[model samples]
Structures are given as C-alpha cells and as structure tokens.
Target chain A: METRDALLEAGAALLREQPVGAVLTQVKAQPVAQRAGRTIGAFYHHWSSQEAYHRDLLAYVLDPQRLLSTAAAADTVLADLPRGLPLEEVVRRAARRNFEIVRANPYVPLILALWGKQAQDERVRELLRAHYRSVTDRLVPVYRTLFDAYGLTMRPPYTVEMFAATLTALVEGLTVRAAVEPEVVPLDLPHAGDLSAAPGAGAAGAAPWDLFSATVVGILRAMTMPADPA
Target chain B: METRDALLEAGAALLREQPVGAVLTQVKAQPVAQRAGRTIGAFYHHWSSQEAYHRDLLAYVLDPQRLLSTAAAADTVLADLPRGLPLEEVVRRAARRNFEIVRANPYVPLILALWGKQAQDERVRELLRAHYRSVTDRLVPVYRTLFDAYGLTMRPPYTVEMFAATLTALVEGLTVRAAVEPEVVPLDLPHAGDLSAAPGAGAAGAAPWDLFSATVVGILRAMTMPADPA
Candidate 1:
C-alpha cells in the first residue's frame, strides 16, 4: 500500500510538472532498485497492469469531492470578492487556479491510452466514463452559480450541465493546449468582455490588466443584458 | 507543387477519416509501388519527411482565410439575426452551426497538434500565433454587433476582439472534446443559449430547443436588468 501510494504520488507530481510522455520516460529511467519502478510494479500487482494503474489514477484525479471542494472554496471567496468584479472575472480567477491543478495532474491525455486504444476492455471504458460524468457533475454548479447570481434562469436538464460541460471541455482543451501548445493561451484568447476587435490593444491608456479586467466585466454585462436590436 | 498539393489533399482526407497516428499506417498500406512510392515518393522527394509534410499540413489547416471566412459568415448571420428570438437564442443557433463545421473536419485537431509541438520551429510558432490573431480579428465584429445591439455598456479597451478570441477558444475546445470524448460531451455544450440552470427534473417535458430560446431571453432580461434580490 505504501509503495502504491508512493507511485500515485510520484505520477501525480510528474503529470503536473511535465507531459505524460515525459513521465513514462522518467519512470523507465529509474534504477532497477528505485521505488518508482516498484511503485508501478506494486500498482500492477494490485491492479493487474500499468494500464489499469492509469485507469485508477485518472479516476482519482477526477474525484468529484476534491474538485467540488475547491469550487466550494471559490464560492466562499466570492462573498468577499469586490462587489462589481463580475462573474467572468470570477470564472477567470477560478479557471486559472483550477487549470493549475489540472496541469499538475495531467492524467487526462494518458487516459486516452487506456480509453481509446484499449477499447476492448469494457471495464476501462466504464471507469473512464464514470470519471468524465463526475467531472461534468462537479462543474454544473459553477455555471449554475454564475447564471443564478446574474439573474439568468438556467434552462432545465442541460442548462447548468451544458455550460458546465462547455467549461469542462474548455479546461480540458486548455490542459491539452498547454501540454501541446503553451504559447497560445489565455493571454491570446478573447476575454468574455472583449468590446473591440483589436488583439491586446486595450484602451489607449489602459494597462493590460485593466483592459483584461474591463473585458471580463463587459462580457458578464453583455450576457446579462438584452442583446436585441430593438 | 502539384504533387505536393495532391499529397496534402490526400493527407487531409485521410486525417479526417482516421486519427493522426493512423495516417502513416494507412498511407503506407497504399501501393508504395505507385506512390516510390507514388505520392509518398513525391511527398518525401520534395519535402524532407512525413514530419515536414505534417508541418505543412498544419500550416494549411491554420490558414487564416478559411477561419476568417467562417467567422465572417457567422457575423453576417448574427448581425442580421432577427430580434424576435432572444439574444441567447441566436447565439445558441450559431454555436450549433459552429459545431457542425468542426465535426465535419478531422484535421481540425491538427490545429492543436501544431500548437502543442511546434515551438522548435520559430516560423511555425509565429504562424500559429498569427493564426490565433487572425481568428480573434474575425470574431470581434460579431461581439460588437451583439454588444451594441444588446446595449451593454462595457468599459472601453476590452472590446469585441477579446470576445471573439474567447468565443473561438470555447469552440476550439468543443472540437477537441468531441473528437476525443463524444459520449461525455454534454448535448448542450455546443448550443450556447441554453445558459439556464433550472433543476434537472421535468426537463423531458419541454422541447429543449424552444426552452433554450426562451431561457436565453430570460437570462438576457436578467443580466440587463438590475438584480432585484426579491
């Protein structure tokens, strides 16, 4: 159990700091006597194989309790947030922090190794799906909070879940993007309140942070307000 | 040049049908006799290797013209969208259309591939950054039309361009999600106007499309109007 826990801890560490590809390489390079290999060996001994170890590793990463707890913290802090900071601002701060967590546990891409190529194992698919559903479930509340706070009525069944899924997808995408292309990130993408078409050309005198803050506020306002031509 | 074009055309088609990893296997299976290998021969003869071929393939996929054209068309529709439907309703319709376009193209994932692994080549990184810039440019006008129509008073400097980039990022995220995890994709993730967070029960009774349209109207009404805290 200790060895297994050590393996999980090590993997989680590597997933956060480097790509999964690099993680596998680093693990293989360990001395024949190091605990890293034994850690994996223990996981396989208990779980069946390295592939199974990853399945459970991902499941652990997608644990809803951990995710929701972080969100709960964010929710608590929202009460203390400046009155007019806006939901987009809230999401951005939350999003960056959340993605940092994801970066550290970059098990998402490796899950594909088991889920995509190992489709023969129905159990793997079920495990992966369950993890995904947990993610979707955990995110729904974040969207629900934003919509409700803004006085937006979430459409039933899919409203909170849908927006939740969109954010999940975006976060997942960003994780993948960071893994693959770290350069073209939030700094480059449009903010929710982008009022102009010019990239990075906030107001003539507005500093970058101010421009970004305003953009966030603006998007929440736009989404909140009436967009009808009338 | 013609052979290069032919290889690229063939490669894109193959990429659309199968995963990037599967491409080489499928290509190699093709009559090497015709391709020394025919188009393969032609491709390698002009280009250094498959990696080079792929690099160009990515360049082609990120070409701003195509992305901008899509943005322009979306803008025309959004700008001239009827007022009868609530603003959220209109955005949802647009989001659905955007998903269909991405679903239709397999090479879209290549956009991420280029983004993830091209920093070694300064030219590739610049091209990708440029592509990111171009897409944002095209999306700004759409935000402007909506923000102006909706009468949202966003602070200056963080204008339509930022919104466009943000929206594009969301769309890109959706495409990647659908490719890797279709089953988990929230049915409503691609549909934007369904921002309502109503309870999950009794959702089946309502026509989701209609409910979504109404809900966006509701959200917009809510966002624009002051929260009564009633």
Candidate 2:
C-alpha cells in the first residue's frame, strides 16, 4: 500500500488500546513519532490533520469489506437452515454470528463513537453512512427471509425499514454502551424462545448481545403478526 | 434558591449559546462573573473543579424533576386517551404534544453532549441513569398500554429496556451528528412515519420539541411498533 496506510495502521493499533481522543493530546502526539521513528511533519505529510487521520483510521477499521464478510457468512449459514430446524435456532445462530463479528473489531466501536454521529467532512460522513447502511441492508433481508420461513404475515417496506433502522441503530449503540458500561450487561446475544411459537417471547440470558438480539427477534416476530386485541 | 442552584442555572444558560468546552475561556465565564459580580474563586469555592461544575451543570439540565415533569405530562395526556377521544387521534395528538415539549428544552441536547459516554464522576453517571429511567418508567407503560389495548404484543420489557438504552445512546450519538452532520438521521424519529400509524416508522413533517421530550416520545414511537414488511 502507501505511506498513509502505514500511519493509519499504526494509529488503529494505538486506538485499539486507547480511545482516539487520548491520542490527540500534545504528549501523545510524540508517540506517533517514536512509533514511526519519524517526526510529526513526516506523519502530516500525507494526511491533512490528526482529526482527518483519525477518521481515516476509523474507515480502515470499519471497512465495508469486513462488515459484508461477516454478513455474508451469517446469511449463507442461515439460508441453509433446513425446514426441519426450528426457526428459533436459525435466528439465534444468525444473531450470534452478527454479535461476534462486531465484538471482534473493538476498533469499530471506537471509530463509531468518534465519527458515526458527526463528521465535518463530506467524505467522512459519506463513508460512515455507507458503512452503516451496508450492515443494515444485510440484516434486513435476513429478517425478511426468516419471516417467510415461518409462514407469518409481515408488513410492507415499513416493517423491513423500521427493523433495519433499529437493528443498525441498536448494534452500533449497544457496542458503545458495552465499552463504557460493561457492568450494565456483558455484550452477548441471547438465544431462547421457539421462533414458530411465541414470537414476542425472548430467551433468558445476561449477555447484552443475546438479550438485544432476542429482543430484536421478538420485535420482528410481533411485527410479522397483525395487531392483536389482547 | 441556594448558591449552588444559581451557579448551575447560570451555567445552563451560558451553555445554550456556545460549546461547554469553550465556556471557561472568554465568553460566558466573564459574563457569569459580571452578572454575579463575584470572582472566579468564589464559584470554584463551591465546586470541586471547573470540570465538576460542568458536570453539575449537566446534572441540573438532566435533573430527574425535569424528566419526570415531561414524562408526567405525556402520561397525563396518555391516560386521557382511553376516554372519549378516538385512539388514533390520541396517538397523533400525543405525538404532537411530545414534539413541542422536546423542542422547548434546548439544553437537553447540550447536556447530553456534555455527559459524553464515559462520565468521569459517579454522580453524573447515576444522574444520567436516573434521568433516563424516569422516562422509561412512564414511556414503557405507555407502550405496554397501547400494545395491550389492541391485544397487539410488543417485545415487552425488552422493548422497554431497549427503548431506554438505545434512546440515550442515540442522543449521545445524534448530538454529535447534529453538530457536524445535521442531515444524517441517527434515530430518524423525527422523520419517521406518523406515530399515529406505524409507531416506529420515522415520518417527515415532524415538529421540533425540547430535546428530551422529543427523544423520549421519539423512542416510544420508534420502539413500540415495527414497520410493515413488503
């Protein structure tokens, strides 16, 4: 690759150990030199500013390729679920796969913490949007496909749309919470409840990922069914 | 009010006009001094540090009282819904009232930004948790009542829990978006489909409200119902 790529890799390594904010200080700026065995000017030669480099670092960590790979892996495995297999198992497996992929990339959460909400640069914003949307696109279809297997009635684009939006929103969000508030719940997905049975019911578990995934699945299950007069 | 109260209120007002990160430097600190006619040490004497003061300022903005008041107002209106008025109208009207309430509290978003993710102080974190839960208590019931009213099941506590966790997470996140990326929809609650119809579907034509109330109601609408599947 290029000179910039090497610097970003160095930065990403630093970011994995500490938040990007920690790296921006004057004192920390010195370490970049030691790491590269060069001066600040040399680091700045290709990247415009430290902030821009951080953004780029996030891009490299959250590359669409990584996300799509995880997504495709989950999708292909889920697609092969035998009609004999319970719907709950398929949903649980897929949810677990998604959670594990996100967990592997701790830098993904850090990058999102700093940039997913706002980036002044158009390119940065576009990159954040594209990366986020790609994940949603993959999950949305998976949810839709699962609903079909259950022989349940589902809503139109809105059902898929809201589910898609919430999933992306929640996963990105829960990652942040896990990093900051580990005590709230360990980041793990729950796998329970018979999918073909009570769609609204969830599996019992302490892992946040499980609970979160189960909850999303439960919500999807409920949405597939029409309004009930309790 | 106590001296502490005065300081907090002053800080909140000052924060509205500019970034809290910049508050100590030139603009507001001087204005606060001029108005109080008190010296810098006088204020510092009451607090642990400037950072502490800002943390307290955030606490005041996110005070449980304010959150409860909003939640209470929404609930009072919610209780009235099962009365003579039509359910659909009640939903629309409730959404409107909530929009207005959230728009009124300009400091909500500011306070959220000030809190960031990893609060250094225990009190601030507890304060934020309490403040968010206040809404969850009121809003969760509203969701339960609605879904139960029609016998339409939601994800129950998971939905409620997710609603609370994700709502605050989105706030921390979207505020950053507003500053640099006002156009990217973090929760898209404002632009979601009409709450009266599809609850979670973000509709356009949303009127702005105080940050807290809008977000509370926004999450309520966003989490309570799922979009239709195609």
Candidate 3:
C-alpha cells in the first residue's frame, strides 16, 4: 500500500480499539507510524501536521464507501427478493441485514464519538454533514425503488428523505442502546447462516432484535400506508 | 448547599461545557474544587477518588428524577386533556414535551459521552444499566395508562418495556442527530405557548419536528393498535 494509505489503515485499526479522543491525543504519530511500519519522517512527509493527519484519518475511517458497500450488499439481497414476498417480510430482512452490518462493524463507536465531537468542532460537523448527505444520496433512490416495488405510496409529511434519515437515526440509536443497555435492546449478534433466523435467536430469552425489526416494519408501513380518513 | 452536592454541581456544570473524557482526566480535583468555590481538601473529604467522584456525578447528572419531573409535567397536561381531543393530539403533545426537555438539558451531551464510555468501562456500563432500569420502571406504567385511556391494546412483540426503550433511544439518537446534522433533523426549539404548535412552526419551510412528532406518534400507534387478521 502507499505510504498515506498505510498510515490511514493503521490509524483506522487503532481507532477501532481505543476512543477517538485517546487516539487523537495519547496515540500520536510515532505509534501510528510504527504500526504502519513507517518512520515518523515518512508520516510527516505525507501529512502537514499531526492534527491534519488525524483529520484525514477521521474522514478515511468514516468513509462513505463503507456505508455504501453495506447498502450495496443489502441491495444485492433485496434484488433477489422472492416473488410476492410480503412487505413486512422484506422490511424485516432489510432491517435485520442493516442491524447486522452495524453490529459487525468496529467503527460504530468511532463514528459515534465523532458525532459527539460534531457539536463542538466545526470541521467535524462539516465532515459529518457531508457524510450524511452522501449516504442519503446513495440510499434514497434504493428506498424509492423499494416503495415502488411494494406498490406502497408514502404518506404526506413523510418523504423519502425523512425515511432515510429516520432509518439511519434508528439504527445508530439502537446500536448505542445495544452497547450500553443490552438487556433492554438485546439485538442478536450476527450468525453464519441465514439472516432471517438471526433477528430473534439470542441466548438471553428476549428477542429484542425481533421486536426491533417488527417495530421498524410497522413504522415503515405506517409512514407509507394511505392515511385513514377518520 | 452541602459539600457533596456542591462538588457534584460543579462537576456537572463543567461536564456540560467540555467532553466527558476531558472532564474525567484534565479537569481533576483542583479545578472542580475551585469551581465549586471549595478547596481540594473539601473535595477529597466528600469523595474517595476522582473516579468515584465522576461515578457519582454520572449518577447525579442522569438522575431519573430529572426525567420523571419532565414526565410529571407532561402528566399534568395529560391530566387536563380536554374531552374530545384526538388521540394523535395527545401523542403530539406528549412527544413534543419530551423532545423539549431533552433539547433544553445541557446534560444530554454528557450523557451521550458516558454512553460512548460504556463500551470500555464497567462502572459506566452498570450505571447506565441501572439508569435505564430506573427510567423504565418509572415510565412504563404511565405509558400503559396512556394506551388504556385511548382504548388501545399494544400488539405482541411491542411491549411496554420495548416502547419505553425505543422512545428513549429515539430521543437520544435524534438529539445527537440534531447536534451533528441540524439541517437534516431540524427540530424546532421549544416555544413559549402550547406544545401543539411547537412541532411544525419552522421558518426553514420544512417542519422537521412536525414530521418527527408524526413519525413518533405513528410508531406508537402502530405498536399499540390491534393486529389485522390477514
């Protein structure tokens, strides 16, 4: 790999293991350079300053490609939807797959830490905004197609942008919940075989993910179904 | 007024201004003591160590009383529900009040920071667990009564526990979303008058909070409504 790429790769790996704040301060250029098998001089050659290097590393760690790839993988599964599959089933599959991807990824904590930083740092805020926009741009069309496939008309006051944003927020929120209060949000860990069985199969008796998936499908249905004329 | 209380208040105040990690490390006894207008001896007299002081501060900052008081205030409004008010209106009012409380609280970022800490720290993890339980214990009955008042029966896989947990996560998640990408989550700030108008009165031409409240109400309604026999 190129010198810049190697440094970023090392930084990303280290970030997954420690808090972003720690990575930025305590773990500096020398450690990252050593991990990349490059000297501090090599690190300085590619980046202007340690802070600048860290900023680039943050961007690389949260690259839109990671999210897009997850979306793409979901698309592949969604593309092969069995004929006449129920809308709820499709939602369950999609939600479960999305949940699994987030659960498996080590970068969630780092992404969340950066989210916390966005409140205080303008540059981080802009980076996250751009990241959100890129993900939304990529996913909105997929959601539109899914709605079209199901022949469901999204109700007024709930646009495709809102759906994509809501889904992203929900997933991110639940990820935190699972980490902090697992008993309450007992999402099942990803298993080897089928994604369908993974939602409810937990060692702990509660099927939190099953409940979560059902709620997600319900929300989607409620948002898309024609409004009742009371 | 008391020494212990004074120290906690100082810590909470400082925590709101900076990241919790910084508060945990850089802002130690002397700064907190000075902030509290007490000496370092007074700080040590109240707490065993910095970590212990932080743990107590975490408890104090996330005290369920704050949440319950907000819930209680909402209850006062619900108690005076004018006859013939639609169920959705009730939901809108309740959701809006909850959103307002979270948005107004400076402790939100601190709580989120602790949530990020939960992955690596056992004490923080347990504290959050206990916090979740206490909040759930307090809120579940209130929700049950609300659903009962509306003659709605919560569907299977969406228990009162799940509802409470999901609602909490949604609020926290949206709080972070608003901070990072305010344009996307554009929740309206709390207004002076009725909570009813607080949802949609945005100048940006898009009522993000209105959409958010509607989506939340929809999720609640869907979870509580009777199942349709296919």
Q: How accurate is candidate 1 locally (lDDT)?
A: 0.43
Clashes of 3: 0
Q: Model 1, B18-107: lDDT tens per residue?
A: 212321112221233232224444444545654554444445545776474356447655755655454554555565556566555434
Q: Pick the candidate with the highest DockQ.
A: 3
Worst 10 residues of 1 chain B by lDDT: B20-29
TM-score of chain A of each: 0.54, 0.60, 0.74
TM-score of chain B of 2: 0.51
Superposed by TM-score, candidate 3 places the C-alpha of residue B135 at a distance from the truth, in angstroms, of: 2.1
Q: What tens-digit string does per-residue lDDT give for candidate 1 at A1-230?
A: 34323322332232222211221211221231132324334333454544444444434433455354346535643652556454444555555556666555424433433333222346545665666677666556655565656556543333445444455555555554444335444443333334333444333332223222332333333234322324
Candidate 2 residues B1-230, lDDT tens each?
44323322332222222212321111233333334555555555655554555444444556666653357446765676567543434444564455445434444433333334333446645765666557656666775666566444433233455554555454444443344434333323333222335453333335433232333443444344432323
Worst 10 residues of 2 chain B by lDDT: B18-27
Candidate with more favorable, higher lDDT: 1 or 2: 2
Instruction: Point out the worst 10-residue segment of candidate 3 chain A by lDDT.
Output: A189-198
**Chain A TM-score of candidate 2 vs. true chain A:** 0.60
Which whole-number lDDT from 0 to 100 does residue A57 have in model 3?
Answer: 63
| Candidate 2 vs candidate 3, lDDT winner | 3
Once fitted onto the true fold, the runs of candidate 3 whose alpha carbons sit more than 4 angstroms away are A1-23, A68-73, A186-209, A226-230, B1-23, B47-49, B66-77, B80-84, B186-209, B226-230
Residue B56 alpha-carbon offset, candidate 2, angstroms: 2.6
Each candidate's fnat, listed in order, reads 0.08, 0.05, 0.25
> Clashes in model 3: which pairs?
none
lDDT tens digits, residues B9-100, model 3? 33223222332343244335665665455667767776678776655555555666646535753584467465545555666667767767
